[model samples]
Target: MAKTKAAAENESQLADPSVDRKALLSEALRRRIVSMEMAPGAVVDELALSEEFGLSRPPVRELMRQMAAEGYIELEANRAARVSSMNHQSLRNFFLAAPLIYIATTQLAAIHATHAEIDELKAIQQRFREAIEQNDVENRVLYNDQFHLQIGKMAHNPYLMPSLRRILIDHARLGKIFYRHPTTHDMEADLGKAAGQHDQIIDAIARHDAQAAGDIVRAHMDLSRRRMTEYVAPVGVEVPLAF
Candidate 1:
């Protein structure tokens, strides 16, 4: 079978001698997997990656292992690695767990975030706003992931950090639906609202108001859910039919 256009582009990037091949490969894999270019549960071909990047099997396997630990991919004994699947059970669990984790982390961030960490989050938020303005969907997803991951770090809870990181992987993946391909006016509005909420989160954290931060995070989660629903079941006219 022939390679897809994305695969061709990835190969081209890997051919650049001035770049760090491993870093390039990892970043490309994350973006592709999160954006559905690789698709959930897609097989990760270790041999192909090794050959394309001019890496040995051990390094390729090591990279895959790192991705697996980060919730980007999964590995099993005697089987090929696969992009983490977002099936019904997984999504249902995400819905059940995400708000709790997000709220917990944000509340903790309110209590523990240092001034410098808040500055870093503001910087990420600035980039996020720029992505939204330019309709740069890929950067929006990546920056949004970074935004939440920074909050997780500020939370300073070893127990919650892992769960927060894991849920954020799916968050970014699901978010691509609305961010990348907005189908309605509401989605565009929600993007603005999300940006506004980030500002609110920063303010609340800066003030050390845990309750307010938690409340803002809840509203943020609701906005995300609504946008995703609008994407899946968009409001419109009747379906076309031919007799």
Candidate 2:
């Protein structure tokens, strides 16, 4: 009887019109961090968040802790929370580990995804395509993140999902940079390939083709890495051979 009542209360809360304060704040902070509005290593102001959400410090701090655990923020014993840093080492690790993680997660998703999950993935792809059409950089990055996150969830592996989540935070941040600087690359062709690959990924998952799914994810990551590298180091001046 007690368990039933608790479940009912949970359902009622879900049905409520107002969003939970902590959820609201966490999402807002997540957007800021992922969009680079907060930038890597930016300090999170607990008091400011409390004021914005109309919540007290204790709850705000709890929200910070949650974000910290999710790799979106870093918390220390005596300091304010900071947005997770993307230093040289972190970026190196991201590039090294992202392909394996994405491939594994996608392969598992192909094996375990349900019809409902595939439907949801298709919906996210539609929004992702629309974001590209509209040139909405933030939403493009956001929807892309959601697309992979859904696949990660479908993987149903607790061990892999957490690492996938952490990897995606940096992935989204890097995507924001890539999208924001369209002049740096052939935006249309690149985005078109991405959109098409998204469809292929969905198709592979629907057909339960784990090997195909893994191949697509690896190719997708390679494209992303190439674009990001091009954006980071564009060809220009000649380097001195001697020295």
Candidate 3:
């Protein structure tokens, strides 16, 4: 009876909505990387984290390996794990390559998306716009990335997804810097500008205008890259003020 009870408990935990160890660890690592809480090139103290999380070193190391594969961390000297650092050249390459890849997927989605998939993208955009107005830019970036990701999902190209996800996320992480800058020329005054572009993309897709959708998606990324180039490092990159 005791063994059966324990088995039931384990099964219940496995079915529990909140029970997702891999997801929890992955999200924790992603937040730390994106918020710069883990400084670029700083070594991750694996032993310390395992103690803090009450897990064995193996699980923590597994998390580190996942982040390293994602380009958020790297193996440093003698197999020491460290967060990845920024390089302007790599950022530029990502900016250039990401849009082309995403645009191509958007074209495919526009060609093939069902009405339901189109509606789902529209819904993601709607919630995204609301998050922006609420000054929940954090949530906005998350959902905004989802909006583009949905496009790729509708593309139905298994081979394209891995690269699409990598590039889009690199831009999403840079969103931390982009959101902080004052709009150089009234861009913030029109918070709707980004939303409008999203709507245009959706409309093009719904109309099955693949070429036009691709063009607008490209233009949106172009404007973002231009604005990001204007982002100054907020004066010396001191420990972020957020507690």
Indicate whether candidate 2 or candidate 3 has the larger TM-score: 2
lDDT, candidate 3, equals 0.77
Model 2 ranges with Cα > 4 A deviation: 1-19, 238-243
lDDT of each residue in 117-224, candidate 2, tens digit only: 999999999999999888888889999999999999999999998899999999999999877856534777898999999999999999999999999999999999
Q: What's the distance in Å from true for residue 213, model 2?
A: 0.6
Per residue, candidate 1 scores C-alpha lDDT tens digits across 1-243 of: 999766788778777778788887787788788878888999999898888778889978888999899899989999889999998788878888999999999999999999999999999999999999888888899899999999999999999988888898899889886577765587788888899999999999999999999999999998887766666677798877976
- Clashing residue pairs in all predictions, respectively, total 0, 0, 0
Which ten residues in a row are the worst by lDDT in model 3?
1-10
Any runs in candidate 3 off by more than 4 Å, and if so which?
1-18, 77-79, 181-185, 189-191, 232-243
Residues 1-243, model 3: lDDT tens digits:
255443355446546667765555566667667656676678888887665444578888888887777787887668778777767776878887888887999999989999999999989999998887787767777787889889999889998888887775566777666775434555574346777899999999999999999999998887787667556433354587788
Candidate 2 residue-wise lDDT at 19: 64
RMSD of each: 3.6, 8.2, 8.7
Name the lDDT value of residue 238 in candidate 2. Answer: 90
Clashing residue pairs, candidate 2? none
Alpha-carbon runs more than 4 Å astray in model 1: 1-21, 234-243
Per-prediction TM-score to the true structure, in the order listed: 0.86, 0.87, 0.79
lDDT of the candidates, in the order given: 0.88, 0.88, 0.77
